[model samples]
Target: MHDQPPIPGRRGFIRQVAGTALLGTGLAACTSTASHGDNNDNTGPLRFAHGVASGDPLTDRIILWTRVTPGQDNGGGDIAVRWQLATDAAMRSVVASGTLTTSAHQDYTVKVDAAGLLPGHVYHYQFETGVAKSPVGRTKTLPRMDVRQVKLAVFSCSNYPFGFFNVYADAALQGDLDAALHLGDYIYEYESTGYGAEQGKQLDRVSEPRDVLLRLEDYRRRYAQYRSDPDLQAVHAAMPFIAVWDDHEIADDTWRDGSLDHKTSAYGPFKLRKLAAATAYHEWMPIRTPDPAAIDRIYRSFDFGSIVSLHMLDTRVIGRDQQLMMSSYFDANKQFDEARYRSDLYSPRRQMMGAEQMAWLDRQVEQSTARWQMLGQQVLMARMEYPKAVVLGECSSTAYVAAKRRAALDPASVTDQERRWLASPSLPCYLDSWDGYQSERERLFAIMERHRKNMVVLAGDTHNAWASDLFDANGRQVGVEFATPGVTSPGMEGGQPQRNPDDVAAMMTDMIAPLYYAQTSKRGYLVVTATHEQVRCDFRFVDTVQQHQYTAAVERSLRTLAGPGNRKLEECPPV
Candidate 1:
């Protein structure tokens, strides 16, 4: 499934490079603000309302993006946009320049792959229409030769209604990143009355359209609303972003054929809705389409000289099978069907990346010679199964806490039922994650093991920070996983406000063998620095997302050494 060559002509610069094929395809800040192209005078000039952005950097090329908004008097029509890439912020020395036209068909958004640029160099870019110029955006090309290190700001699950984007603001202010990696859930597909509605009302950040997205226009409006945020705009202006979609981009719990949130009866055909979402995603997002024909095929890889090989995978839309639900395995009287559930859970046919994607990943891993092989993906790859009683709601968190205390105080006082519940067999906490596709996960593990590579997986979507040891079915360490907390989404503490979040985190760390660290109360992001010696992740959290003004601090720092036999995470002193 190699990408075809770059298409010809104006759009020809778009190229897709995964393992070996060059396929022709197609931030934030409180310190910066984006213009929505709203003009009180109907005859005002065109505006770069969405600001400027760049992404998917190769040694010689990078994708630049922006949106053009026309004044009411201008009417709906095609507008020619001019772009320039320069080595200096003042645009004194230009390197690449191009002219492209955008229209309402693409929501007036412009994206161009600026080529013929030098590697490992910082460049400034901007979009222009008449005298209306966009904010200057900063981007860098991937290093083509030996590199000492690469730093990335990792983020996910930024539901607009949830809270302020202080996380993005903090990252943008630092201004010391190679790029930003967004592991899906960049946008939540919920109506005003959905997921973060109450918070949105309090923060005055309610979702636009006021309904769940189903059409192309609906999705575009939502992206516009999110991009309009000052913090989000500042980040994009600061550096490039390598992003992949999780379920929320289209609908909740989206698989290949359908989604849990998409009601065919009310939303029309799921395929149509999915197509609309994909179209909007490509148009609004500064990402190069690997295969323009197959909009869902976003899995690709990036090489930072010989230091790192970053593989961005699509674990959500491209090839996911329908998630298995526990309710399906229950009988009339609520008797559990453990055998049936286990059989389906471990079925070789149940796929996460399907066959083609798995083959692509195998080839990528086998061919890469970089010191670190990193996967920037959505969802946790580590095992997070909990006791069956806890998963089935038979044992509440409070009850479990009490039982543990009682057992510690007097072993003789423990009841048989309490002991049974405490010692119950484990079941996966979220079947929607890799835990549901165990066979596929093992296959991926085998690929890493066979190549004898140093693997580090950066993940999101759980809305909590976690550091875990990745082990295969045979109990051999394959790698380590560092999951970033949500940008603004609530964590485990959101569900259990009565209990102390630290106690919850401690309980989880105790129960899960592979889990080395857990922070289940905060909303934050991860700054991952990969070097020849090790890959360090700094889990930084903001004090509150409930307000625009907040303070951020490093909650934890952990690292995994790079080597054949070392694939576990070790805590580091806070910086």
Candidate 2:
């Protein structure tokens, strides 16, 4: 069983702090100077190290979170912390105030639901223990009515060792955002010598613990190390977050039963490790648990008045079955087993979001009266079909690009082999995404088409920016997807180092029917702005993450109109 902290009941507004009501008149930008209490004097035993954050914001309630570090003199026992919510940056016009206790069981992390707040209003919050005070955090409640527009900053795949979180820093400066959506891989479980170790060595941002995270303490330490970064702290302080876990939060390519990265004989039972990871995630993250008994059941929905209904889905840990590997479809004669591959690819038993969650999603969409139904989830949901020759490694991206150019310039210059390769059947490139579970994807599309509602999907985990039109098996467009690039993780450029990244992106867009835009090289996030008429997505890319100082620019802006039979992406000028 998972060890969880006691959840406090929602309390009414208490008496305001004296002599600070005037602070609400003039508000400033939300920024945090707290860095693991490094800049503060060591006078008190308790200190706010990880800074303050708020998440899971509702119209009248929001989850406020912070961690307190106890000094050696203060024995490892429970410590009382006080939190206050106000209508000002200085936290002077205090609205709600409460006290909570934290112990080592929860890694000294405190989470409280600040209730009794006005809807569609920006609020400031802070945590205090003795003389130590956490940096003030700014948060907004979800709009209840009269909603015109809602803007969100979407991000994912932030590998600390890869580089600086310049994307987060840039997004933090955007004061107009309503909230931030983190589509997981929030923290990696790799050891210091694993994955991005070489980059860490060069950038001096190595992973903590120096070993793979298998226990609760390891995950806790890793979360602390990530929270200490100034860029991440600033973003958290700037606005509330709605987050869900992806594979790297526990292990790579994780499914319902096990993960490809884990070995049962060497790592022991995968369940115990998963529990530890989940427990640490709940303790550290600001998200509220829909079911305290079930830590993995994070599929939930948020309503932004009558304008947008955001349904965050758990497509990673809860219901995903083992991914289909291409290696299993090869025969001893070195020929591909097309018959068996097709049979298993369309297996009805294969599940992506599981039956229970799928049913719940159906109910949510059916009941929602909002103009836009947005699905915020992990992994690509669109069909990323590639030529069979490319899937089988018979033709490299460079070779395909060269062949296409030659064929375009002079038809007689194209070889017969090149022609055959170009005419090969198209197949799903990544089996781990919705492409692997075709039946389930069709079921979801059917649900959207049945409802006849405007749909938009926000996706991540590819570490690359993409915009694709979502279509069903019957060739009917159901919705559109806007996938954000990684905050720091490398994309396709990292894999195809020899080929030009522009060529790879151009070839992908040219070949893929649904793909409208593709940025295979860059680290950044996506700003999605939704109005009543249309939803626009601005793909912002940072020039580099290798250094603390960098420049950011909007690479592309795409939008889709609202209404039935209009679910297609069109390029828009960058804002």
Candidate 3:
């Protein structure tokens, strides 16, 4: 198991007093400050070290978050904090105010749901204690009705060690967004030399833990490190966020009970590691939960009035079964084999969102009165099957050969459904996505059809931009999906080495049943603008994540009408 760095002890009384005094004085003297929206108030650090954030907006309320880093005076103990919500940038017209306490037990983080605010109107919020003050954060409540437009800045998979979070900074400065939707991998849990260590070495942005996270403290330290990033802080401070965790928030390729990254032999029980990871997530993120004990209940819905309803899901840790390895179906001769497609792989019991959550989703869809139903979840729901040439090309790689060697030794372990796709132009089910649980995807499709849901899916985890027409196996259109590119993490080109990324993307679009557009080489975030007339999706891309600064350009812009009718995507010229 990985070890955590020791926490510093409390400072001396005199030193603490001096430090606090200097901090307060310096913050007052500073010219670069956070104002209501107009004034430039001193914004650096006085009390809040991680800055202020807001999330999980509703028609009447919004959750505000901040971390109070206490010094020797408080002995890192609980401190009474005051929070205020106002409608003006100057914070003179206060609408709501409250007092709360936060301590090390909850990681000194403060999260207060400011209720009674009008929907679709912008609000400014801040936290204060003694002479210390937090940077004001801007947030907006969800619209209940008469919502003309809502712009969401979508992001995912921000590996700190990989590169700069230029996408986050860009989105923060854009200022036109109503909210931000983070589709997981907000932080990667790997050692300095693991995952993107090579890039980290080049960028001088290494993981602070310096070891792979396993224990509770390890996870906490990792989140602390990620929150320390200025760009991430800026984005959080800029707008309200709706987030869901993918595998990296816990471990790589995480399922309901286990993960590929877990090693019971070295890391002990998988449950404990999962607990630690989930605990840290709850502590650090600004999300609200009905049952704090039920870490799996991250699946929930947000209604944006009569315009749209966003359903966020816990696809990684909720009810997902272990993934089926494709190499298991390959024969010893390195050729595709059809005999291994097992029946259990298609078993109705196998689920992406467990039975309970599935039922909940169905009810949410049925109950929604919104014009558009948006599924916000991790992993691509669109089908991606490989051609025989692509499969052979991928299989011929050294990595695939090694994987095949491992699978051949455990042929009995291969799932039947996976084996079904092992033949000519096999569908190499991306074990981590909806493709791996065909029955569940089908069931979800049926549920949506039953509800007559006019839907569009917003997905991440692919680290690539995609415009796909989602359909049932029988070739009936269900919805259109827009999979956003990464905030910093690599994409398909960065993962598969056998074929050129552009060539592979072209082949995928040409071969896949409903795929319309695929750009797997760029690194950036997405901007989704929603209105009653249409939902506009802008696949924004940056020149590079490797650099400290880069320009953002829209790689593609598409839209779909909002109605009970067809949800097919139509390409629109860039704005």
Number of the predicted model whose lDDT against the real structure is largest:
2
Model 3: per-residue Cα lDDT over 1-575, one tens digit each: 21111111111100111100000011111111211111111243337777889999988999999888666677656799999999987889999999999887887878898888887889999999989988888888888787787788888888888788878877887778988999999988888888788998887777868899998888877887777777788889889999999999988889988887789999899998988888888888989875886875798899887888899988889899988766666678866564455465677878888999999999999999888889899988888654443344533222332333445678776555334333335453465778778899999899888988788899988666788888887888888899887788776563345545555555455456577877777777779988888888977776667766566676577888865565888877544
Clashing residue pairs in all predictions, respectively, total 14, 0, 13
lDDT of 3 at 494: 38
How high is the lDDT of residue 253 in model 3? Answer: 86
Give one digit per residue, the lDDT tens place, for model 1 in 1-575. 22222222111111110001011110122322322321212255789767788999999999999998777655777899999999999998998898999988898889999999899999999889987899999999999767899999999989878888888888888777999999999998899998888988887888887899999989988898888787888898899999999989999889999987678988899999999999999998999999999999999999998888999999999899998776677689867788888999999999999899999999998999898999999988999776677656676645665676688899889999889877787776467789889999999999999999999999998777889999999999989999988898876664446656666666666566798888767788999998889899988887778877676777677899988768789876445
Q: Give the TM-score of each candidate.
A: 0.91, 0.91, 0.85
* Superposed Cα RMSD, model 1: 9.6
**Candidate 3 regions with alpha-carbon error over 4 angstroms:** 1-46, 331-339, 392-426, 495-502, 563-565, 573-575
Weakest 10 consecutive residues of candidate 3 by summed lDDT: 16-25
- The residue-by-residue lDDT of candidate 2 on 334-449, one tens digit each, is 57777788889889889999999999999999999999999999988998776677666687645766787788899899999999987888776477788888898988888888
Distance (Å) between predicted and true CA of 453, model 3? 1.4
Task: Decide which is better by TM-score, 2 or 3.
Answer: 2
Q: Give the higher-lDDT candidate: 1 or 3.
A: 1
